[model samples]
Target: MIRRFITRQLRQPLPPARPESDPYARALPKGDLSGGRPAVVRVDGATKQALETGRTRLLVAAVSFTLAFTLIGWRLVDLGLMADQHEPSLARSLSSDALETGRADIVDRNGIVLATTMPTASLYANTQHIRNPQRAAERLAEALPDLSPAHLRAKLASGRSFVWLQRNLTPRQQDRVNRLGIPGLYFQREQRRFYPHGALLPHVVGFTDVDNQGLAGIEQSFDDVLRASAKPLQLSIDLRVQHVLAQELAGAMTEFRAIGAAGVVMDARSGEVLAMVSLPTYDPEKPAAAPADARFNRASLGIYEMGSVFKLFTTAMALDEGIVDLNDGYDVRQPIRVARFTIRDYHPKNRWLSIPEILMYSSNIGTVHMAMDAGTPRQKEFLGRLGLLQPAGVELSEVGQPLVPSPWREINTMTISYGHGLAVSPLQLTSAVAAMINGGTEARATLLKQDPAGAGKGRRVVAAATSEKMRRLMRLVVVKGTGRKANTAGYVVGGKTGTADKPSGGGYARNSRIASFVGAFPMDDPRYVVFAMVDEPKPTKETFGYATGGWVAAPIAGRLIERIGPLLGVAPRGDDNELIEQMLVDIETNAEGRQLASN
Candidate 1:
């Protein structure tokens, strides 16, 4: 009976269970609307899995965006505040080859490009792949006229894996070579150092090797710095002033028939080198072909006994150390004799000359007496303090070491005081002179630009009072002394003339002399130091066969100061009454030792 009942229930189709009770049935579409109950939509297992994955992806994207923004913000902060000690990022980015590997540029203080690198293509050949070597050589020679056809042929036929046809090729040249349709002739990317000013700043900017390596001048002194840095090296040189100085120096060289010449213009207050010139200079583009003499930097590398320019230092030492006063006088009646040497003045005044007279006339005997009073120890210390006893501390590798007497004997001191027995470069002399007159502040020569505020913090080398006296004395020299030729209108030019016989055969040559003149303008408020020097200048008809400093170099200084004054914005002062009257001193005395003005 139970078997029969189970069979009947299964056959009735289990009376169709309700859709609300079946979870799987809720996801199916309703077939008819007759049921009155609303259909419920349920999420399937696959849809739930897809939604979970989407949420995970969105969270990851949000985290990544947050990290990216944080990194960008951190980098900005680092550049603005943390990188203050680093080089200027903007300057580094502006270099011609800053996008690739290249040396930094060298610019003048005024942002004029002195030395730079340009994009170039170097021609190289894979000899094995080159067909018809002679044809390739002939075609290449046509493109590069400077390259010899025979030389290029030999290089292509060398059977080597690679060979260089040319180091630097211009865009036109590269395009011409490409038109030849020669296989194995290819261009390798390269950079070539270029000096836009050419010979204008060869000595200071210097040249590079075939591989663009620094070999001399500021280049050698700061090679690693240039290679690693992207910013330009801004030198203290002003291109405008440099051009004027070079032009004048070249004219003097030709006029005087000088073997060589040098000139320097420096700021007395800041020790900044406004202009430096050495002739004959070579074109930096072809330094290898230039003569050896043209490569020499006479301003900083050639040491010489600077003649009466040394007297400036001697007089300053005496005044600063209290060994002598302006009123003191020395008997210059005869030439001094000491150990087979006779110290004679170029323009001797045969009488008891006052200190001002001795300096103005450049008396050797009076200078010797002043040195003896200061003693040898004091003389050595004074010169050492002025940075004259050692190599000049400039920004060049070719600085000259001063020739000093090892014994430091009394004769040495006396001779050195009168501008002999000691040899120093023109750069050293200019630096010392700047210090002596710039309110006695130590003026350090440098090639790099200096900050205006930081320039005045150097050590005090001499008393300000002593410096005032020196300014007056130098002005007297230009107005009524050997430096008369250096006096320019409205400039109040003040300076000293120096003429030293060149050393030959263990003695000074009577004929060959090094003539130099160093001057400062607007003596009421000294601004610039202008120096000119001529080596082995021959006498000219204009000077009546005189190659002395007064005839040769003094006039150059005067003309240079006049041209540069307006450019430097130094206003001309017409009235000199107050300055002249204040710096005046009694030139002679009466029997009662009272001061008296000389006519």
Candidate 2:
């Protein structure tokens, strides 16, 4: 009977099955309305086997995917949760326990915030958890206008679990984003360095990077010290003094129409830096926005031919070695000729000038003659001792390397006498000045506040008598010579004026010049030495169209002393006019005054 039934079933033509392309693959098709009954067909054995094989393959693939996801999750949890191995990330990587993680605040001597690091939250998202990427991104985009909707959509739609949306967002933005109630968004804490004073002490305190890494200035030099200690990094800079210096320097820059300006105020006794400024400085809070030139630290880093300032060193060397006496005179009536260059005075005396008068008049010819008398070997030896022809020992990131002649030929000796050929940084000049004033001690500069016991306890660089004579000569320059404009009332200011034409290709530019004034206050009891300089100041109506140091840089230093004296607690003393009789002589003052009366 079974054989007979099978034969009958085979003999009957089996209905064909519907294709799977139909809306319901396994469903039966409706019958035609022409009175045909609804019909269905069963699958043959071969077709049934194919369907079973496809189902088994799909199940295997799904199982493999699940196992892969499980293994990936297990590994991630293992790596990220091993906090004991990574001592820093026990709770989070932002913890202060990590070495070099959190730096101490940088404070001025008075404990004002020049630099500090603050913890901020950064927003990220897990795209795998994002159900509706478009809606979530739309909401996030509204909260962060900097983000484009389409780009945020891609970020949300990405398969990544940890994608950054924004870092260091503002508090208001964070609050607003939290209110939006996005599901997959998360926050991670990070350190953001801030400079509240902005550009006030740009070169002194310096600026950090976006990641709180030290990039320049003091920040870079003392980074290791800062990271290791929680105590405030106390600097020699007083913010008040820094502000006064910056305000005065910026104003002078505007008044003189200078291309650049730099100034420094140092303690003549201890070599403490009170205020130093280099402009046009940029805001440390936004260092990337600043131009390349604005980032240049000119005060300590720019080496220039600082015209007559070197004469101080030359005269001191001559006197300390007994090569010349205060009464020894040099015939500066004629221009000095060597090889192709001539050393000549701008305003010549055309006669013999005493040692003191030579510096007082800033006679280039007289200085050259004095150096020749001192000889090349002695000149080199003296300058080497004075620290004039080398890198400054100041604690700064951008100290300029002095451009001294390697061979130091006879021409070099002559040119250096007139403050040319050899170039030196302003910081080198400041240290040299302090050496000349502090009873001839060579104190190295430091940024850290000076402790009673420190390494800068200096060695003697010159004789005390030589320092006294140099002080008188510096005073003479301000009282009766080219630096007359630098004499402040009751300040007992002493200094020399330097007007140097900037060197071009192999020669000095004809019209472009640098105006500089280096001074010390209370010359009789020297306390502080200040150096002010202007690069390429243009002729102005107020200056009587003069671009010399007397017209530009001298008054700037005088004004700075006036502004900073009270701030630094330097009480202004009465003018030491009693010493002027011996300090200034043959100053066209006595001779010209008599001549005017006789006429």
Candidate 3:
């Protein structure tokens, strides 16, 4: 009976087989099971919820990854292609060859290097990568003794992407740093402006800051030119002449016990400055450590009452204007009182003096008389023509403008005739004197190596004949009068000696004086103008207890001329006595002729 019942139930079309419940399956469509396919199973609520959550999470993760990659790609493009627009200064600093080709070298006329830029390793760091700040600082401090460990630790601990560890590291220092092998440490290429001669040309070649910006002298004046070109900037300076001038000036400064000294050697024909020196100079490598006074450029910047040097201009003016001849005489026996000012001679001859004698003796009284004859307007015009009334046209920026009397009074003219009342730099005085003796052409002093083809035939300042007479008169001074100490044996020297009291409290300080000598050698045809000045020189035993220009500066000029004559290719002659005798004869004849005319 049971078997018959079971068979009947089994055969009864099985109330449609029910599908089993599964955790991951869902219900199928109504017709999906008609072709003997497996029935779809139903899924539990927790399992379905988990699957949806996983799908949402996967979508979010994919979108996030795609956005991150896009942003990274855009940033790479910006840094690679458009970095200059976004970060110009950083882009410039990161260039591999920036410092190597930034500035040009500076050389003298003979191709001697004065100033140059050298490659150096500068230490920097990515502080974020530093594992231990204290350890890195201690290790770096050993390599760079000048750097403070405390400061280094502070910089390293700052968490900055870029931190300056040190600038301009020496090769030894760089090697020591590399040996440390610390993470985050880096080296960047940089440049340092170097002066091979150090203090030898501190004032002329000047110095630059850490970033290589020029601050003074030719460096300051030609900053743009130096940075724009790779070719060296050539100056008209002769290093050999510079060395000689510096040695002589330093010796004079020490011997005379002077507070300061200045010297200039210039080419009379081309107005090129071969040498310029100022004592109490400092090292260009360490400019900040030097005193302000040591950095002062006395040759071109410091203006002083140039004393008797002005007499050369006065004599030239009088002779050029036809206002006075070589025979013209002035009665300098007594002091002239003009408006409470007594103009007296430092070396009073107490007699009438001729024009040539006026310059030979450095006679302030005779020079005043000469200037009076020429008149104030003519004197100003004449000196202006000689370039004494304006700033010197040198390449340096330290040039001083001449201090002229604003009222233009008669006494002003008298004092100016003897190189008082008016103040000018040594450079200006040297240049003006060059004009007087250089065939009376206006000497526009320059610091550049002049091209012969482009060099201007300078404007005429005085007649050639007048300039010849002035040259003869200057020679007479070195041969017989105040400049006798400067009369070298073979080289014919011509110059004027000046000793002016320092101006103090609206009056002259009789004790303090500026002793100076401005001279030209081989006077037959002058080639160079040599000027030496000792500021506030004290009397020394060797100087016979006298600190006048003749005693203090004349010897320096003589020694300089003797040494540089051969170096400058100026052949020394046998004897200058014949030339001196001829000048004496001319002076005597002119005096006798003037006496006859008066009689």
Candidate 4:
């Protein structure tokens, strides 16, 4: 009908038979053509008007077709050639979604992938266009067993323009949904934050939510950095060292039947945390399913009174301030009475003790006297400079605050001198200890990789001579003191043992203790500061019914140092007596010290 209408519209109505009476018609002589010339006839006004209308309609139709084709071609070019290829969803979801960057990958200093983004298909729907809602829901449920058909059907039936059917669908599941050919069911290409190392790097790399927002650890701390930058966040962590630390810490935790365990391996020179382990850790992929206790980061977030380790600070301060020398003696013949409390050493010498002997025996009373000589004001100032009087500035959101006594009285100073009144995170202690042994340079622990040239010299926290004396004392401890079990051959390990009773209820738990050891290798020139702590460790047969730091935690450090030293290319210098003699103090040596030196 339309074709006939167009044909009629284009055809001028036949000029009324003008043959009989019109002069023009008579002139034309009934369409007769002579002399090879056709008869000419004048067109009527209505016919001319109809012809003009037909021509105008044809031109309009042609223009419309050209414009339509031009638009289609431009769209094709825009999508195929001019579109942002980097933005995978730009062209498809332009109107409904805003531009977003893919979350940057997190890698270790060695370029090992700790956390990354993986492409996945997420199912969504335009409920308004969904037909046969119940049927579609049933088919989707069959494809994705985890999703309920009833819930899906209710969502599809709801008179809404958009709704999420499911997120992070596996390829097989996505394929199954596609085969259903359900209207309004679509797949949105999305990136899911994936932890390739799973629980191993969970606390550091952290986990993300469905929308790829960082929630904990370094991820949470550097969330804005991760989102804005496309480059991978390189951490100071060494995957190899992390594995070693975690393995040894887990073994220690199990052997001692402890509640938990934490460990750290930091470069004393650069303050780079090569390895940090907190056991009972959760998998980043299934963070929600993990218990709250499992998510607790003990290494940096759990603050405790770190027993005799504070002696390292106390001794360093006394020496740095010229208040005490290696030969300086402190009378610890009896427990020092301070108010209602008394400072007593677990292994009391019951005699005047030199600074070296004080540290070698880990005498609590001796440390208090040393702090007294340094004076309370000087002790506080010294600890503050060592980064021990505050929270550690580590690059993590779960950092804990150090608990220092308010109105710090003489008793508080005495107790803090032995690590009772002052509570600090393992990180703080480790960093401070690192500085004490690393030529007195202030060590600031960090998670980000450091530039070799730009490690930026740390401010001198203690005198180089004091640091050297501390190193000698630490070496004496490992050689002939409580840390004898930590004497790994050829490593020249130097360290301190801490066995602090866990504060419980009101006072402190008798049996429960945080046994810890902080050590550095190559004592002549310290490198890494390795620390290990076991929470609430119980006595084991291997430990000879002792759960002190020397028994429970020192061996862990020794083993870790022994293993990681070779891996880190630190060749063992077998019995470098010359180096040992250079830093040796003029103290009376027993038969044990002679035997250890000979060996």
Candidate 5:
């Protein structure tokens, strides 16, 4: 009809009819012959008017059609390109529904995903377009009974264009929800971060929000790195090693009836964190549902008076300052009388203890004398060199500040020597031990295992010779001293044991101690350093009314070593005394002092 109308509206006037009065006359009577020159009859005025109007109408119609077509093309381009960026939906940014699409998975050093991103479908609906909001909601609630219909109704009544039903549903649920076939409902592909290992490494592999924003742990620390790259992130953590640590620490925490537990396993040479476990840990997959207590990462964030563990640092200082020799003896029989404070051992051994024996027995008196010889200035400087008295050298943000006595008095130094007046985080202790055992090169503990060819550079905190001596002494402590319980059959583990009285209400809390053990495996050539701590452990029948580090933390470390050694490439050297001596000579030997020089 429109076409016909246009044709009629645009039709031109017909040529004036040939004169019809007479054939010859109408055709050309007044002018000469029709075929010859003089002749056509003139058109009437009405014909002329009709012809002019038709031309004007056709021109107007042509212009209008061209302009309308141009506008339609312009709008098409705008909708296709401009609207996508300028008027993006809230779902695009607020919900993980958009960003998680095709996100890379998170894997451990051994390609295990303590956390992973799985592709899943999210359910959403437009309230205004639903056929029957109440009925639809009922169907949805039935499909996912976890959702309440009242809540669904309120959400559907929110009058919003889009409301989220759920993000990242399981395939079975998605199929069920789809079976409902409710109008205005839709599914969006989303990536959900799933922790396959559950609570084992929650503190290491962090969780992500619905939109995949890292909320905690390594996930939060490296959120930007994960979002920007497609490749799987390889954390320095070994999942298998982490499991063993958790199992052993949990058993110890239960046996001793401790409030909490924490531990770490770091590669001494590269400072790579092979395994780190913080008890009371939560599952990363459901971080929101976890308790805050379970979420606290004690290994990296919690700081405690890690008792005689600091003795390692003091002895290192003494050796580095040339304040004491292996053969040099200090009289530990008399408790050092310094002002109001008195320094004594847990089980005092009254005798002239050599440098090795002082460490072997964890003698407070001998350690105080050793610290005094090195002096406050020298001791503080040496600890600072080892990254104590400050945050650890790692990428993690939850670092605990070391609690050093401000006055730096002689009494304070004495107490701090036995690991009492000072507090350091577990991470700090492990990193310091890594510096001591990894050939004296101080590398900050790393959660991402670096490619050996491209590993980071390190700062040498102590001389190679001093580091070797410290390692030997530490091994002696594990072999015959407080840390003897930590020795595993296959791994020539050497470590130190510590039991610190917890401070309470302006003074030390008697009978309350933080028991801990720090060890390194394959003593002849150190590989990994393991540190475990149980806070406020109570004496149990199994422990024989003792909660010492040797009884509590050492056994845990020993079990962890035995289980993780095979996985960590550490061979057993239970009878390799010759190899053990290569790192730690027998302190009782007459020529022990000459062994270092001979080697």
Candidate 6:
């Protein structure tokens, strides 16, 4: 019936064919109407215009869609084929710009890497996007075994938008997490501070916190400079010298059964610290795991009474002030009783001693007499000038302040003259000794590498003649006195021995002692100052059951100089006793005349 209806409608569709003269009929194509086919039907102008507009819009839409799809396809091909070449360049660009956002590196004077920063991946999550929190946590825990499953589940179920899963993940760990295909898990790029030498330079280089903030040593001292600059911070430390000093110090500490040790190697002429070590040390990369005592910097931060080393200052002060001469003699046979204190010699000579003999024997009675003659005010002034009354100004935040007597009485003066009643860090003693031997010029101690051409003319703490006399006396000590163990052959080693009892319970401890030696080689032209100290060293069979500086610390200094002299380019010369004798002719002649007169 439907087919018959369509046939009837088609038979009636031949309403009227327009003539060729009509504009609308001209628009239609010419065709024959026959065999039940519908004849042409004419429509109004508005309907024809609407149909033309619709066709134009459809054509424009097709072209736009085609162009968009073509561009997208080209992009996919470029990414897939050129990924190997493009990825490395992209990584280089990111690494090159890392210093702007990350911390700068730290290196030794030779440009050896000490501390640096590297890129790492940190895992985080958008907890809201995680479905089935328990299952997601279990999967994540498997990928990162260090993370707790319960912790992860709590974080994922907290209904929070974001949470940190782990920080500083390794490449393998990151790959494992990615393979888990967790929906909410993500990775953030971050930078971490690394120490290549690890425990070797914990005290000097220091360590940083998780946020890359410096907390100790040079790291704490120069934190702002490290964060703001792109260039590596170079120190005056020579890695070779550092190793030798630390090795020698550690050996001595172990052999003597010391509780701790500290050592420093410094260029006497320039005042640049070549090496500074304090033990026991810690690993900079894992400072939190180390004990507090391991992190203490004894060289610069720990203060103690440095015993007979203080005599160097007292003798230098007397000579510089014209209060005493090399031939000056003092009777050191009797002990000096000042108020409630008694000053006596460790090794006594029951006769008069010349100035040189007093220092050689380390006579505390003679030193007290010298201080009494110089007066308390002059001794105070002299020490203050030597940079001992104040804290050391080296490039370290862990520096110690000297403990000086408040009233500055005569008893204080006498005890301080023999290295008691005043406590100073080893750095202060080393720096002051450097000045005394370096032609009397006070070179401020520093840790940064310095240009020799730009070095300042240092302040004169003593006259050049006084410094020469002090050197001669130090040499005399090494040749015939307490520092004999420190006299290495051909180097003309000159030094002072110091053994101070550690203060305890309002007095000196009988068993605990600080044994130390400070020495300079080729006394004629001193270049470097080497200082070694052992804290609370116990008596050993090899040391004759005594833990004095001459027995324990002097041998360390002697061995260290022999090893480092070649490395530092200090030439060995034949024994210069004849020359030293000629320089000391006046003192020898005076002593002979006194002996002849007494005989």
Using alpha carbons, what is the TM-score of model 4?
Answer: 0.79
Per-residue CA lDDT of model 5 for 1-599, tens digit only, reads 33554456446443444545534323445455344544435455554577777788899999999999999999999888887565556544543543445345677788876666777899998888886788887888999998999999888877778999988899999999888878788898767888887888878776788888887777888888877666788888888888888899899888888889999999887888988888888867788898888888898888888888888988988888788777776878898777776677778877667788889888888888888888888878888888878987666666667888888887777777878777888998999988887778876888987878644258779888888888788778887788888888877888999888888999988788899999897877888899999988999887799999989999999988888888977777645555346324445563454445547
Predicted candidate 4 versus true structure: per-residue lDDT over 1-599, tens digit per residue: 44565566547543445544554442445545454434445455655676688888999999999999999999999889976774766544742332263577889989998988777999999988887899988888988999998999999999788888888887898899899898898888987888878788677777888888889998899889888776799999999999999999999888989999999999999999999888899889889999998899888998989998888888888888888777677777798776677667787767667778888889988888888877889988999999988888988988999888889888888889888988998999899999899888888999999987655289989888888888888988888888888888998999999999988897899998999999998898798899999999999787789999999999999999989999887889876555346335455553245447658
Q: Sort by lDDT, best first: what order?
A: 6, 3, 1, 4, 2, 5
TM-score per model over all chains:
0.82, 0.79, 0.81, 0.79, 0.78, 0.82
How much is 350 displaced in model 3, in angstroms?
A: 1.3
lDDT of 3 by residue, 496-589 (tens): 9889889999998988999999999778889899999999999988878899999999999999999998999998887646656866887678
lDDT of 4 at 507: 89
Model 3 reaches what TM-score against the true structure?
0.81
What lDDT tens digits, residue by residue, belong to model 2 across residues 1-599? 43454456557755664665643334445664424644445556655566677778889999999999999998888789964677755655444453456688888878888888877888999999889999999889999998999999998998898999988887898998999987889998777878888887788888787677788888898888878887788888878878887887788888877889888888776778878889999988788889989999888889999988888888988899898987777777889888877777888978777788888888998888889889999998888887877888777779999898878788988888878888888878887898887788886766778875643358888888999988888888898888988889888899988888899998899788888999998888887889988988888988888998888889888888888778877788777576568545545455565457758
lDDT score, residue 584, model 3?
83
Clashing pairs in 5: 96-211, 236-447, 490-572
Candidate 4 segments exceeding 4 Å error: 1-99, 127-142, 148-150, 156-159, 179-184, 577-585, 589-599
Model 6 scores worst on lDDT over the 10 consecutive residues at 26-35
lDDT of 6 at 574: 86
Clashing pairs in 1: none
lDDT score, residue 288, model 3? Answer: 95
In candidate 6, what are the lDDT values of residues 249-325, reduced to their tens digit? 89988898889999999888788998999999889988989999999999999998999989999999999999998
The TM-score that candidate 6 achieves is: 0.82
lDDT of 2 at 321: 89
In model 1, which runs have C-alpha deviations exceeding 4 angstroms? 1-100, 575-585, 588-599
Candidate 4 structure lDDT: 0.84
Alpha-carbon RMSD, each predicted model:
10.3, 17.4, 12.7, 7.7, 9.7, 7.1
Off by over 4 Å in 3: 1-101, 453-456, 586-599
